[model samples]
Target chain A: MARWGMVIDLDKCTACGACMAACREENNIPASGPELAGDGRSIFWMDMLTITEGEYPNIKKRMLPRPCFQCENPPCTKVCPVGATYKNEDGLVAQIYARCIGCRYCVNGCPYNAKYFNWYPPRFRDEEKRYLNPDVSVRPKGVVEKCSFCAHRLVRVREKAAAENREIADGDFTTACQDTCPAKAIAFGDLDNPYSEVSRLAHSVRAFTLLEDLGTRPKVFYLTEGEKHGRFKI
Target chain B: MDDSKYNELDEELLLRPILKTGKWFYISCAILFSIAMFAVWVWYHQWSTGLGVTGMNRPVFWGIYITNFVFFIGISHAGTLISAILRLCQAEWRRAITRAAEVITVLVLFFGVFNIIVDLGRPDRALNVLKHGQFRSPLLWDVTSISIYLTASSTYLLLPLIPDIALLRERKTRLRWLYRLLSFGWTGTDKQKHRLEKAISVMAILVIPIAISVHTVVSWVFGMTVQPMWHSTIFGPYFVVGAIYSGMAALLVAMALIRKLYHLERYIKEIHFNNLGKLLLVFTLLWFYFTFTEYLTTFYGSEPTHMTVFYSKLTGHFAPEFWVMVLCCFLIPLAVLVRKKTRTAAGCVVASIAITIGMWLERFTIVVPTLVNPRLPYPRGIYHPTWVEWSITAGCFAFFILLYMAFTKIFPIVSIWEIKEGRESSVSETADRVKTYLPT
Candidate 1:
């Protein structure tokens, strides 16, 4: 089984939101509406948070693209009363949409605010629904949803790999965010494979997980910009 | 044993059925219950819609729903702890008060559990908690412990009432059907009396710890969390003390009301209220001491997270509520209860009302303040329950009162058998004691 992971290189990345847009479209997430901002109804699977540090005129902006960390010891998974959410055999914390009781215990228990509750029955344009990937299940109201790392794409990769009589490749199961990154800043692959790009990037000196002190052991890593980008802000 | 004594007992038994048929009894019940039913209809709207009906939002995920949960649960501790502890301590005045307190426990426990469903985004999914419950979670512990306590409390309430049921069965022929069905063949034989005594003894002994665990577990639901204000070690004992404090106040309210409404002045006298008021005063001081220590340590530590919540309660948004709660729960009650003049029935009722309100504010302070001030740099949370939340909360209170009303109709609110036994046993004993102590 693959130990799925991602490494985002801050130095190589521009502050473009192409990855965010791609992730939303690929996952059929709702576009940001005025009423939904900070309401837990906005369905941004890939969120861009801008952190500014330093005094007025010397301000710096660092864009952090956050997805669910898919922690090895996921607090959200641990607190889910219904076994609706759990860590799979491959270490990915998966959500069983049908099984979720909509307790929101997982949402309250998650420190990162990675999970989002479906406050309303999902609303989408007719044309947009037509474009949605048939493989992913649309969530109902009250259930929580989050970035699944395009796990449906991985299932497709597995099927294709089986049919072709070959093992899955690193690029074969790339998430929508990684596939559409203009700067090639995001690397997604098996971290256990020594030769995989994700493993190589993950072991970089600047690679770190957010709130590492929390002991969540997040599979997602962020690579800070070098001395030239000045300082890591916020 | 004599004709005059029999006439008095007969008069005592007649009072319950008469009250059940009082002029506005059913009319008032209908009006109050229809309002409760309307509230239930509103709850259905909440069930269909999402939790958006409630004013809960990001960061302040819990509001009045959770606060009411804690508050109702706090009031429930009044029953088993006070009654059982007093019984064990051999406080004879407890005979009249125990049933009142125990009934509150069962009703409040039911109300408290319902409040959780009201808080849920999906009330239908409540079974999922039991089906896939995590034993390690404090919530699951709460489910387990509270259920056990409820069962024990209900049994304790019923066991002592068996003899009374038998009395109604034998003495009152008109109410023979109910007495016959409910009395469980309670023949006042020596062996039966022995078994009843043994059962009551077992329950009184066992219930005290279970009662204590219920509130301790409740406190742990918040204390186990890493939230700034909630994660205190003192929470367990602090909650237990608060429970007992408020429980005594509830007892006073019930006692005074029952005394007036049922004319149970002989059973529940001024001495009973005086004893209860004294206990309430002790808890008032203890609760104040705990609050002082709890806040003083946090203030001295000056940790940003703890101090934020502490100052917020002391002099911020919650300051008015906090100070008012202190005055109502402790200062005024303490002043009134200590003075001989103010320790009367009306005075205790006022003090009890004050304590009840103060305890509710305490629950709100505990639940909301910590939630509003999370440790992170994200926006601080604020909560104000929407109409849906308010209606359901009102429905819960109405349901509690309705249950108590139903209980009074079914059983003698004054514990007729206990009063008989007290009258029989005490008169002889008091004369002997008085004679023994004279001119000593």
Candidate 2:
């Protein structure tokens, strides 16, 4: 079984927010409108974590595009009483939207704060509904939704690969955020495959996972923003 | 105030509210019932409109509902644990007060469990917890323990009540049918009384552990999580202490109210409060120790994640609530309950009211500040409970009082047989028991 993972190179990222927009469209995440957004009810499958450093005019800012880390030892899934969120065989942490009791236990359990609860039913104008990705389900209000590593794309690609009598290859499935990165910052592939880009990127000296000491063992890695040093610089 | 009334201290005063309905009782019932109805409507509004009616959002996934859940559950501990302990110790003074305390446990538990359901984003699908039960989750542990506690506590509340219900059956009241049905054919034969007393004694022994487990499990709901300040070793015992502290205060307030409303001064005397007040003093000290240890450990350890939440409560946005909680749960209660001059039944009630409010704030502080200050650099979440939360909270308190009032209307709030039994035999039993324990 393949463990789907991601690596985002901070040095290459421009933080233009294309990934956020593309993710909303790909995942059918509803536009929560300004009022709800201001109330902290806004849902973002691929959100930007803006890191501001230094002070005054000398300030440095870097936006890190964040998706669910899909931890090997996911604390979120462990606390879900209903087993609504779980790590599937392919090693992607996925949600069973229908089964979610919306206790929000997993939301509180996750150290990274990756999960988002739907505060309202997904709403769109009659014309806007057509723009929603047919492959994605519109999550109901009260249930949590998060990054699925574009699992639907994986399913479609798997079917295609089977029909062609071949293995599901690298680059066959890519997350919306990874596909939309103009600077080629985000990498998505089978982390177990040593030949895959994500696998090599993840082994880089600058590679780090958010809150590694938490023991969540996140599959998502980040290449540090500044100068690349030490071993495996490329 | 009558000399004749003092001459005869019997079940007549205890049964007065049941037999003769007071005007204020009906008035309070109507008011409480209307508020409860309004709260139901508000909850429905939240249900139909989604949980968004409350001020809860992304980071602050829980708010007043969780606070109320913990608060009510903590209050519930006041009843069963105290009554059980008193019964186990054979405290003669517990006779008039145990029923009042037990009723609080049985009644408060419903609200405590219901707050969790109401807080659910999908209350309709709550059965998912049972269907696809994950034992690993602390929430499931809570579900299991609390249900066991509810069953055990309700049984505990009812077991001692059999003799009282049987006595109520003797009176030719309108609801004599319920009394008869509930009394379980207790003809008060020596054999029946012996069995009933044995059953109550066994349950009294059993309930203390169950009661402790319930609060500890409740604490684990937060403590098990990896949240900064929450993931602490002291939480289980700390929460149990707080539960008992709050429970003690709640029981005092309840007893004081019943004493005034039901003209139960002859039974629920100042001395009962005095004994409970002494216990309350010990708990007040214990609560302070736990609070100090918890915060100090967090403060001194200086774990950045823990510090953020600690500072938030200590001097940030939650400073007012934190200090007030300290005042109510610690300082005021300590000041009022410590002195011999001020530690009256009236003083106990005043301190209890403060402790109840303080404990609720304590729950709020424990739940919110951690979520608001997450480990990540996410913007800090500020919680402001909306009208929906406030209304439901007020309604629950009002309804709890209303239930207590209703409890008095149907049955004697004071156990008839136990106190009568106390009157007949406690003196001799104590003398005999004392001699057994006395060294030659």
Q: Please tell me which predicted candidate would have the highest lDDT against the true structure.
A: 2
Query: What's the true lDDT of residue B101 in model 2?
Result: 92
User: List-wise, what DockQ does each model earn?
Assistant: 0.37, 0.61
**Model 1 per-residue lDDT at B235:** 99
lDDT tens digits, residues B1-440, model 1?
Answer: 56214347544543564334686667768877986898889888877877766777666777887788888888988888888888777666887888888899988998888888777766677787788777766777888898999899989988988887777776644667987888899988999989988999899999988988999988987776656777799999999999888878887998898788777776688998888888888888999999999989888898776888898899988899899899888888998899878998889999999999999889889888876775544456667667887888888887788778778877776666666666567567657877987896
The CAPRI quality class of candidate 2 comes to medium
The lowest-lDDT stretch of 10 consecutive residues in candidate 2 chain A is A225-234
Q: Candidate 2, what DockQ?
A: 0.61
CA displacement after TM-score superposition, residue B247 of candidate 1 (Å): 2.4
| Sliding window of 10 residues with minimal summed lDDT for model 1 chain A | A225-234
Give lDDT: candidate 1, residue B174: 65
Per-model TM against the reference? 0.90, 0.97
Which segments of model 2 are wrong by more than 4 Å?
A225-234, B1-9
